[model samples]
Target chain A: GESVGLHLPTLSVQEGDNSIINCAYSNSASDYFIWYKQESGKGPQFIIDIRSNMDKRQGQRVTVLLNKTVKHLSLQIAATQPGDSAVYFCAENAGSYIPTFGRGTSLIVHP
Target chain B: EAGVAQSPRYKIIEKRQSVAFWCNPISGHATLYWYQQILGQGPKLLIQFQNNGVVDDSQLPKDRFSAERLKGVDSTLKIQPAKLEDSAVYLCASSLVASGNGGEQFFGPGTRLTVL
Candidate 1:
């Protein structure tokens, strides 16, 4: 079946450094993608999203890049902070609008 | 606006017991979804409703899990005779329109279930 997956299970970064999380999806038909940040004991929160038609989209302090050719997605965080530490997940939506999520990558920021 | 709301932040029960979780989506939202998040994994869609109607539930374990939305508003999900594997977090979300149209979804705090 079609699924989304992360390249790493966990990533550690300095507080002031930048962070990049990567994801790969199998469904070529998927048209929209979203990135979510999940804190401990909380539901996943929407961070940013990009459609298949666009290669990249920028948010307040985050950016999402989609590569249709490689079926890859990435989220970049500028100036990682302690509060930014959490599990980040990537989801892909096909025609049904029901999103399929990746296993998730834990972002650990060290001060 | 107030975000999605869910009750019973945590629950613990033995195998074979029954449990139910409630969810209230954002007002005026037409689409609602239920997802299960296991430890160290992402949330998985269990079912979706489009204004009191079922849009998809292919991943829901019908034999053990059931859900319903009344009057196209509040919704509830029930699990009967729960198993140890059922221990996870249940998340409810809502969107202004059908997700297929690319509507952004807001999520609730989620209910954590621990089946012994």
Candidate 2:
């Protein structure tokens, strides 16, 4: 069965520190990956995305790294802030642009 | 622009009961998606629609769950004889199209359903 999973269910970080959340995917043919952030009572919002053609992509204060060989994806947040506390979900495009999301990783940033 | 709109921010029902949720996607968005999100888990795709047509419903539990997007603008998801396991957040999202970039979805504040 095709599935996506996270290495950790929760990640806590201190203010101004860097945080890393990891995801493992089972589909090698998966071509696109995305990171979404969901705040309490809000829907998930797009953070960053990386295509299989690229190994890394960066956004305002976040970066997404894709390792096709290992079927792993990681999201790194620099200078974590209290406002960054939320659940982060990693989605993989299995086929036909249908994205399958993994169990989310709760990121708690302490200020 | 206004984000996706969902009605009845929260609903509480008992097992064997019925409930319906409504959604209005962003203007001009051709793709609409419904998802179920359990606590501590990611959103699971229940169905996907493209302009009033069903694009995908592979994960939908047809015996109890049904959805429609008749006008290509608004959609309704109905669940009959809901079960306790059906307690979860119902999220509605919209995208311009699935052709490029997986259509970067824009989501609405989800409707939380509690089945006791």
Off by over 4 Å in 2: none
Residue B109's lDDT in candidate 2: 96
Residue pairs with backbone atoms closer than 3 Å in model 1 (clashes): none
Candidate 2: C-alpha RMSD after superposition: 1.0
**Model 1: CA > 4 A from native:** none
DockQ of 2: 0.69
Q: Listing candidates in order, what is each one's chain A TM-score?
A: 0.98, 0.98
Residue-by-residue lDDT tens digits, candidate 1, B29-51: 99999999998889999999999
> Which number leads on lDDT?
1
